[model samples]
Target: MYRIFIKPTLILAAIAFAASFALSHVNKITRGKIEERARQQKEDALKAVLPPYLGYTIVEKNRKATVEGIEFFYSIAQKNEGEKILKAYVFECENPGYSGIVRSIVAVDEKLTLLGMSVIQQAETPGLGARSKEMASNKTFFEVFFGLSRKAASDKEAVSQSWFEAQFTGLDAGKKIGIIKKGEWSAENAALRQELIDHNAVSAITGATITTKAVILSIEKGIAALKHVLEQENNAPGEAASP
Candidate 1:
């Protein structure tokens, strides 16, 4: 009787082991496809912000190894048939939203202008900060940075940096982009501030100032990160355009 029961138990154990091995193999086989699908989804979001007539390529094919401390993927979008690098970028960033982290990517043209940006991932209050992602209306929030450049052309101010990073739009690369201190800013900066106010200048979500600032600083840091990268690129040898 004992022998008869033991044999049946052993057979059941062998079958269970076989099933586990098969599932493991299937997981390995499909992993590549799964990863590819995720990558395509991200690519679609980034491309939406870029101009339709422009062309671009991935400077770094993989996002994980490109930048440190930032958990999202990034790529440089270049526009030109060839040889001309129109834009240099690092994509995807995380900021605190009304409810949670809001993630996005910042793009700068070869001339160091903020070309466009997109929110790739975010979890904010359903109607407030979440609105930051709306393509139709929320777009103005991002467009505020277009053609924006640093205020001080000299390394002194460029390197000084700001906790609440200045938002200066329509700025050429070699200009002093200023900001308003509630009332002290010049007409130009005040206009910029008003535009941001009209479009939501990193406004705190109704009652969620912490969450709102998180998103604001995230964009700020995103700009800072790109600035740092561009500065390095400008100093790199063999990258100078021939006259």
Candidate 2:
């Protein structure tokens, strides 16, 4: 009875313990690398959303605050002349999308004009909602087939900005940014794109109005939090308002 039941049970328990220990050791070894990669990804997203102008230094404050009972994180970008010139405030926000959460980084200037926005994380539908992060390729199929594409030599440079996210740039963050179903935006249609920009609106992704509205809601909530924090900081005793 000892060899048939008790001994086998003890051996299986030992094996399970050994496997758990090995997994724990492996996790300890790779934990730092995982965290570092996440940090780097976040830093890259911050840089992507800021204005394209040169000489601005990004400082990741990672400050935490709450507005309307929701927590938010923000950072600042500055230009160093003789002194620090406040360039833009970058805020990270997320909202529930059609399939999952869609997170984005948004940059706005002192006057609340949106500098840019980048969708960093999402698990939305593939063809429709996930297109929010899709980059527009500068070269067409025919251009590539003829080998006449300017970026043919470097495929990595062939893609331009994410059309969905790029539409938020230069819009007013202080006011309600609108959304219209004009069509998927394209650089080729410069005139129609300008019309949407003039209306302070972004063209909604085809068949993904829920995902589009989720991003807009996230931006609106983030801007409101930023305004609240800025107001608090400006009113603090002996502290000048942030430029």
Top candidate by TM-score: 2
Residue pair clashes in candidate 1: 151-177
Model 1: residues >4 Å from true position, as ranges?
1-40, 63-73, 81-84, 135-212, 233-243
TM-score of each: 0.48, 0.79
Candidate 1 per-residue lDDT, tens place, 136-194, comes to 21123334456343332342332221112233222222222232234222234566456
In model 2, the Cα lDDT at residue 155 comes to 60
Each model's total of backbone clashes: 1, 0
lDDT of each: 0.51, 0.83
Error of model 2, residue 137, in angstroms: 1.9
* Model 1: how far residue 96 lies from native, Å: 2.1
